[model samples]
Target: MVRSILSSSTENVLEKALGASALRHKIISNNIANVNTPEFKRSSVLFEERLAEALNETKATPARTNPRHLAGHNGGGDFNPVIVTETTTSIRADGNNVDIDAEMASLAKNNIYYNAVAKELSRYFSNLKAAINEGRR
Candidate 1:
């Protein structure tokens, strides 16, 4: 009962996204740190595509009238960010594929994305708080 008030599926999904963003931030920072190392293939976290696919799944499920009955597939409930190493390309002579320019660009974009998601999450809780307080007045 308390879980229903504190969060919904949307909130859960946003929290997962924030977690993915934090992980992506760490991975990107690691790549940037190893920019000068030899043959250091840059790594990136892939989350959005998989998350979207999970959320967009349209598989059919049997309807149950009872609360104890079996539940259907949960969208975005099992999604996780995947870390991928770029191993096919090397621009420098040392065979290192860590591109400082591209990484920096990605960092900026990710910062904005993270901030946006955080703001939205904050807004959700703020609305909930407002509603709770309004009931007392």
Candidate 2:
């Protein structure tokens, strides 16, 4: 029972994270594509820490005693992630700050992490199916 619950929760978080990561990847790709364009400052996604903090806050909060109580003030499961930020560092002489090499590296790492999360989600579903079909085993 506990495993199933935890798996479901993890799957939810992974799904959200993957969505955010994919958005980041797209933005990064766009930045790289527009590296030659004039006045492109290279926006980036900034949600990993926020997402983790939101999840942690949700976990730390006690369950509400009232059914109609507003949720998510603390651990209320607000999963909406932000995906836009300006770099603190300066840009190139051409006013384009996106480092293609760095963005590509980040994309590769994010892809690997996304794949792992997907595999874990699949395993979780498969385990649930196995448990449900135990009678046939």
Candidate 3:
């Protein structure tokens, strides 16, 4: 029962998003750290579109009667987003394109978004506990 609750859909989605964002954060930090390096193209994590598509995939038809049987279009499992490409958006004239201002902005936005998701997850767990306790009373 505990395992089932821990593996709930909400938890899975939140965990996947958090993992992806954390990896993106690491990549962004690396880019900032290497801003002064010559010939270094800025890398970025591209997972939004893929994540959205996976969220939309649902199996409306099932071949087997089993609950786990193939259903709604497969979400294609966990997101394995990779660094799609490097950008040459030059913010400087030295042939280097690492824009500190843009990177900071992105990092700040990502932090805020991640925090919001975490808060939501906390609230969800709290509500679940409340529901469980209410049933006992």
- Strongest candidate by TM-score: 1
Would you estimate the TM-scores of all the predictions? Answer: 0.86, 0.77, 0.78
Candidate 2: residue 116 lDDT (0-100) = 81
RMSD of 2: 4.5
User: Candidate 3 at residue 13, lDDT?
Assistant: 71
Worst 10 residues of 1 by lDDT: 55-64
Off by over 4 Å in 3: 59-72, 87-95
What TM-score does prediction 3 earn?
A: 0.78
Model 3, residue 90: displacement in angstroms? 5.3
Instruction: Give per-model CA RMSD.
Output: 2.4, 4.5, 3.2
Weakest 10 consecutive residues of candidate 2 by summed lDDT: 72-81
Estimate candidate 3's alpha-carbon lDDT, on a 0 to 1 scale: 0.75
Q: Write the per-residue lDDT of candidate 3 for residues 1-137, one digit (tens) a residue.
A: 87875567777777767777887889889888988987667888877777776666634334567887655556636566678546646666666778888889989988987788788888888988898899999
Evaluation by TM-score, superior candidate among 1 and 2: 1
After superposition, candidate 1 runs with Cα above 4 Å error: 58-71
Report the lDDT tens digits of candidate 1 across residue range 17-56: 8999999999999999999999899999999988878877
Number of backbone collisions per candidate: 0, 2, 6
CA error at residue 16 for candidate 2, angstroms: 0.8
For model 2, the stretches where C-alpha displacement exceeds 4 angstroms are 1-7, 63-76, 87-89, 135-137
